[model samples]
Target: MTVPATAAGRWASLWGLAIVPLLLLGAVLAYLVATGGGLKTLQGPPVEQLKVSRVTLPERGVIQVHLVNDGPQTVTVPQVMVDDAFWSFTAQPAGPIPRLGRATLTIPYPWVDGEAHKVALLTSLGTVFEAEIPVATLTPQPGRDLFVRFGLVGLYVGVVPVVLGMLWFPWMRRLSARAMNFILALTVGLLVYLAVGTYLDAQEFAAALPAFWQGTPAVLLIALLTLGVLLALGGKRQPEEAPLGLSYRIATGIGLHNLGEGLAIGAAFALGEAALGTFLILGFTLHNITEGLGIVAPVVRQKPRFIQFALLALIAGGPAILGTWLGGFAFNPVLATIFLAVGVGAIVQVVWEVGRLVARNTAALGAPLVGWSTLGGFTVGVALMYFTAFFVKF
Candidate 1:
């Protein structure tokens, strides 16, 4: 029996695709063997790269740093300096750290609260790496007390404000078509700010990533992928269709943004910047209050049930708690950057959807798409977010 031409072609394609990766691996293996597992080096000056991944204050007068070796050569932490003065430090698993290895250095110094500090590490190869502490405070460890503290912070910053904003539902029911158009347009404005700000934050984290990671490109690609996927998921709805679905999508996008916010707050506290964290909480609380208005904009005509409201709040605010936990305990630059990118993408997609809704509403009411009310509402939304953002400075 002869195989069908289509089946034969499919098999050939699959086999050819499978062989590509094998060929790539074989090439790498050949290079590794030929170069004696990369031991044979070309003529060049010695290269050393180290990253101070984290700095923690375990207790008063105690400074701890986590370092990662990212270069081809082994790195040794021989000397440490604090405030431009040499300070002695003890490294766990003492000795040179091979490439991709990690080490923790413990230094005992009198670090004062609310004061800035700089810690520098000198490698044996005369290379220096620096980490900064903008404000000195105790880094909270994992415990019940810490959990409760972070939970409260997330609640105040992420959950309560969003829910409070949602309470505008009753009052929004009384608004006329023009007012509703203003609100939907305002939602678009808010989402635009969020998308831009979130992407900027992702870029900031991406800069801290190791060069090999190519963090900026990865973030951009991931964000674009996310935006495309979300847009596709929305399908081809009618211009004014899917109010309930739109509301949920808005909540989900805002939830992702809140997740990034929680991560920042948690990381700030973990890095011993309590004052900065507190200010973030205040700013984010005010910033997120408007988010609820966006969430309910579509459902304003529908009179969604109480349970729907609760679910919307939870959907929009729950990730923040999980983000705080991750940021405090297992924060990684790569992960943080990815999450921020996802948030940016989601917010951007939501902005597009909300804009469509606003346009549809305007068309239904025989008003110009970009009327005075819409422009005014958009301006108010952007201005509100921009001003509130002042309280949060990285």
Candidate 2:
């Protein structure tokens, strides 16, 4: 019943292909077991680590805290203290929180306005975790009033400015070839600044997450993955592809960046920082006007219709409203960090594509790509962004 040599060779090849994956899987299992699944094993006394992921003042005299167990074992929060005074509190899903598990604790404390307060949690393992409120103010609750307020902010910061910038399309269409290159270079500069800022913001948010989440590595991986995916999606445009396509892509990138901006504003307001939120509105309004120019640069040559321009404006600015809603109602540090990373990646992709367009334009004009106009335009773009950023603070 032995198989023929030809059939036996085919079977051998199939087995070989299957064995490679099987061996690799076995290796992964062995590595995981040896490293204890990348978790630190407590060697001595009960080790507990807790993270205060968020704090909210839903009403005038009550505090809500979100907690996550970021340790190697289960930990129970047995006592709570506010401002060094013992206070009674209730925990949702009362019990010990296992590794990476989450819970919410509500405490009724008469916190005064314009003052600082400290909330402390005493764990079963005799470890204390403290969360500080730098300023006592009422957190924004989800409601029609809050929704309308956030919407107005987004409209001012995202939509109005972008539409105004797009208004320059008529003027942009009249520029010389050399001048067009300069404008495109300026767009690249603007996008580069945005990308860097978004990435830094992502890192900041990542640092606020629980230690067990490996936030830094996660941000790096997600940002890189986003960049790779976007590049693949926009690898090369065919001649038949309309210029509107490129413009839409640019709008999409700017829209994502604006979404991050909206999240920042909403979170600031959620934390009751009215001043910071107001400043953000002003700063982003100025900063994002330049984004409209970037979006329209590719399409000006195409002479796209008015309806097309309207679509571009919406595509570029509409996300801010959605972002505000999420950040105001359900802000999560991990989600915010991921979104910022995505914005960074999208902007980087747009910058690459825009740079290529600039280079191509320069070559068509038989001029040097890195001339004075390009350099100066880029400098001005970066400088403008930096100057506007003075309004946005952590």
Candidate 3:
């Protein structure tokens, strides 16, 4: 006879239905209470620190400034300067930037100095917020560029374990179906953490946009689009017959996740925070190992060739390189949210597939839904991420 879930295990299923909504409600309420219980609209000089959100070259003879308004009231900026040179916005911004919004200024610049330059903004009351412009690189030094990008963009340390694991994939195929299912479920747990964490990380960044155009909506839209794309791609194909394809799906999801990691690294580096960039790289590298295991878990049954495994790894890992390149040069909060949403959507699909596989295997063994082994495996998978997370923020 199959055993029933215990009191604690019974609560776990409901958690899936209840926790996110409760937390979201709590977050909304906390934000309201913390900000005087409602949105405040105003215009004046305010005593709040302004931050340089991003700086970009829009065109020749032009530099664009994006200022993040973390203040309670909207404030009018009277002037902005680059180093000792004065510049004016070509066109005035529509209105005072709302709280948690970003303001943009486009200034003409005739110089193309390769050296670092500082940009400053002055409010009506003479409050100044300044940030350094990233030094321009006119020519590419391949070796140095690769070193900086890889070391800081999250492609290093994780490779060691991932490589070793793939080397042992041949032996893994010998494991029984139950063993593979345990591993599959465990991988699902790891991705469970990833999907949730990825969305949470983008929340504040998404909040910087206008209230109507928030990250939540964008994420939902992108996730749905990603799912539609995946489903469309698999039109009329059975999951069982195309077992090798499952690995590709997993890799694609992991690739999307890694691309987000690259964005973090690139954004950090672009803003001149090398330490944060390095920390992000290290954390992502560790996750990359677990991601590799998640990708290869299907191979345990399919017995894919080494060439196939290598291609899957590249499929999953190559995006990190491209993401780093783009993120360092140009990043928009909206785009970042979309990238993360895509990853979340794809990973959720993978989790569903893995769960179905696990259910079929466990049903054969007469195990309960709350079987200790499966639960233990999942808990372990979730805990594994904590090791890297503790050492550095992901």
Best by lDDT: 1
**Clashing residue pairs, candidate 1?**
none
lDDT by residue for model 1 (1-394), tens: 3569889999999999999999999999999878868766764777999988888898999999998887877888899999999999999979999888889999999999878999999988788899999888887778998898788888888889889999899999999988989988888888888888888889988988866678889889999999999888778766555898889888888888888889998998787767777888888888789888889988899967899999999889887887788777678888888888888888888888789878888899998888898898899889888987877754
lDDT of 3 by residue, 272-368 (tens): 5677777777667665677777778776767677788788877787777767766676667767777778887888787777777677778887887
Per-residue lDDT of candidate 2, residues 201-230 (tens digit): 888889999998798888878878988998
* Residue 263 lDDT (model 1): 90
RMSD of 1: 3.6
lDDT ranking of the models:
1, 2, 3
Go through the candidates in order and give the C-alpha RMSD of each one to the true structure: 3.6, 3.5, 13.0
Residue runs of model 1 more than 4 Å from their true location after superposition: 2-42, 60-62, 82-95, 108-117, 236-241
Error of 2 at 333 (Å): 1.4
**In angstroms, how far off is 4's CA in candidate 3?**
67
Which candidate, 1 or 3, would have the higher lDDT against the true structure? 1
lDDT of each: 0.86, 0.86, 0.70
Off by over 4 Å in 2: 1-42
**How do the candidates rank by TM-score, highest first?**
2, 1, 3
Q: For candidate 1, give the lDDT.
A: 0.86
